[model samples]
Target: MTDDVLLVHGGTPISGEIRVRGAKNLVPKAMVAALLGSAPSRLRNVPDIRDVRVVRGLLQLHGVTVHSGEEPGELVMDPSRVERANVTDIDAHAGSSRIPILLCGPLLHRLGHAFIPGLGGCDIGGRPVDFHFDVLRKFGATIDKREDGQYLTAPQRLRGCKIQLPYPSVGSTEQVLLTAVLAEGVTELSNAAVEPEIEDLICVLQKMGAIISVDTDRTIRVTGVDRLNGYTHRALPDRLEAASWASAALATGGSVYVRGASQREMMTFLNTFRKVGGEFEVDEDGIRFWHPGGPLKAIALETDVHPGFQTDWQQPLVVALTQASGLSIVHETVYESRLGFTSALNQMGGHIQLYRECLGGTPCRFGQRNFLHSAVVSGPTKLEAADLVIPDLRGGFSYLIAALAAQGTSRVHGIDLINRGYENFEEKLVSLGARVERPSAS
Candidate 1:
């Protein structure tokens, strides 16, 4: 494997404008939802990322014709000729993404049986596929585990049933939504994840003639439909990407105008940014975030499912918190090993301490599980450049932020991994006046 590396010259503020497209989280799922339709679906505002490419390849392997639309970032997917793919071709995508698990539902509906290869994603925590299989099993699908992968067969029509997730897992909720939409009866799901991306998927499905309802108590009810048609809808802006840029601006003491960033979806993050002495202005086009000229204040924060500080936003913001004046406490409730990335920050001259006990407002599932999910960040320390390696998507971006804010140049390895989520990130960084360049192959 070719490991792509970037040389980053530090101490430069990232000041400029960049545009964010459809959410990385929502776009891929929307692409998968097209398999449930009888006709072609048009998805606008799609970001060109590795995950999208992975899904597109998988869809094409299933005989779905995917082509670019007239407009930029638009995808036209026709699933009328969907067919079973070669097992070896399907296994080639194994360990590349977790999207294959989602294909089981739509594939099971179209074809009698579906084969799922080994799934892989960011090594953040234990994101088990048990929630997915359990929901499928409740819908009357039989799964057989083999050495290569899991094979699922639907002898009869799938019937929707009631399900309550142990946690508000975004993936499991999506599984329930995708499977329940085509089942025989109504599916009532409690303790569901109500993230904006999930709601957007629901909207996409609704446009495709599916009946779904959401309640204030995190409950969702979906009545299965016999048939679904194609949908033409523009996806929501990527709030997670917007927040990453916002955090980059705050960390480097610069200003950035993120076009296509919606304030409604990022209200919680904006509030937390202001609390940390970051300035922002929201208008019709997008939101402009900058570090106000002052010592950044420290605050306590926690990660929760929807309407709370997002776990994805925690890593980049932690880089900014390292520049704050005092102690900043962060509790990561979503992923157990999410805070482990801070050790690299400590290597870069930031003082951050990890703890097993919850350090923020609420105690979480990881509190008593011996997981180091909490952090104490002491800031106002001068950050110096160090040799850094990209960990995961969010953690990799955090390392970039740290490198840009530090005093000297740093070499960042495995930067190709960032393309899985962020689209054209290196170009965007350069546009923001960040001194980043790929070293010539020696």
Candidate 2:
């Protein structure tokens, strides 16, 4: 695939309707869960994103059959012929995504061993794999850090145990869920991440004959079964993507109707958006997001885990906040390096200042640390077109939004990185009347 460039003619509002598929965070993990099943799993509403393709490749490497169903965006995964894959091929995928770490549990159950290559994701923070190995060790898996990658071997059947997270890491929680579902005994997890995607994964597992329960609090109980069959389930919509487009609409002074967006998953974001002077209408099919014909209001915001405002939603919304009437503060409590993207925004004529001290919300892990995870935006600043580089997934989309909201033209490099999360983003942008052009190959 070519690393293409997008020349965007700015100052035009992106208005129209675009539909969202399954949650990118959830669908790939659910596909990995199919390895625990004795039969084939049919997953509906699967998006054709790079992350999903990477997971599907990893799955096929482990001898699972991955193919599409009759309907569009449907994947039929069959794991009957489970086998080990070549480590070199696995290493090749390591640089593409961090998803190979998630294959550990399912591979352990099927082959009694697994190899995880050097993980790669957005350069947002230190996303260590220690939580994964620590959880695996508790379940009787022997871990060794080799020169190439981390290797694991399960001497016996994994036995469930009570585990509590030091912090509610989403990946660690998923590692526990996928491992606990087929372990020898009942596993109880406290301080688990109850994100909607996690809950959807649990629903898929339940459909596959695994018994799991979630409480009002952040506690989950899983009763391991000797065997699990395949499941047929539809995935939840991508709230992150939905909110990204909503922020785009707000930033560009436009309107967008995102089909398949769920009201329940985005309640917190919706309330926050309304507070920031955005308007929306929700119905059975989807939601319509628009700017209310006035300067957007500046509001204090904080990024947290699920049930709080999402960290992914913060980046795009910050672009809209650049057009807000007054000062807006955002304290990022998730990734330590997430605020690094603000420098590019500043280069594009947005006034955003980074600070080490947590300013707007309660002190988080990054508070007082050297990392500049907090930002204050003095908005109603006119954005000017500048050559932009795609930072991370969310940050890249935020740049696109900023470009669209700016005057004149902007050249965006590394447009391909957006494919990891957003599906057919260029096509979607074109559908919404975005004046973007991709240079042809010489």
Tell me, by TM-score, which candidate is best.
1
Off by more than 4 A, model 1: 1-3
Give the per-residue lDDT of model 2 (tens digit) for 147-237.
9999999999999999999778899999999999999999999999989999999999999999998988798999999999999999999
Number of backbone-clashing residue pairs for each candidate, in the order shown: 0, 0
Query: Could you tell me every candidate's TM-score relative to the true structure?
Result: 0.99, 0.98
Error of 2 at 20 (Å): 0.3
Prediction RMSDs, each to the true structure: 0.9, 1.2
Poorest lDDT segment (10 consecutive residues) of candidate 1: 1-10
**Against the unseen true structure, what C-alpha lDDT does each candidate score?**
0.94, 0.93
Tell me how far the alpha carbon of residue 268 in candidate 2 is from the true structure, in angstroms, after superposition.
0.5
Which tens-of-lDDT digit does each residue in 1-442 have in candidate 1?
A: 2248899999989999999999999999999999999999999999999999999999999999999999999999999999999999999999989999999999999997899989988999999997799889999999999999999999999999999988998999999999989999999999999999999999999999999999999999999999999999999999999999999999999999999999999999999999999999999999999998889999899999898989999999999999999999999999999988899899999999999998866648887899999999998889999988888999999999999999999999889889999999999999999999988766
- lDDT score for candidate 1 against the true structure: 0.94
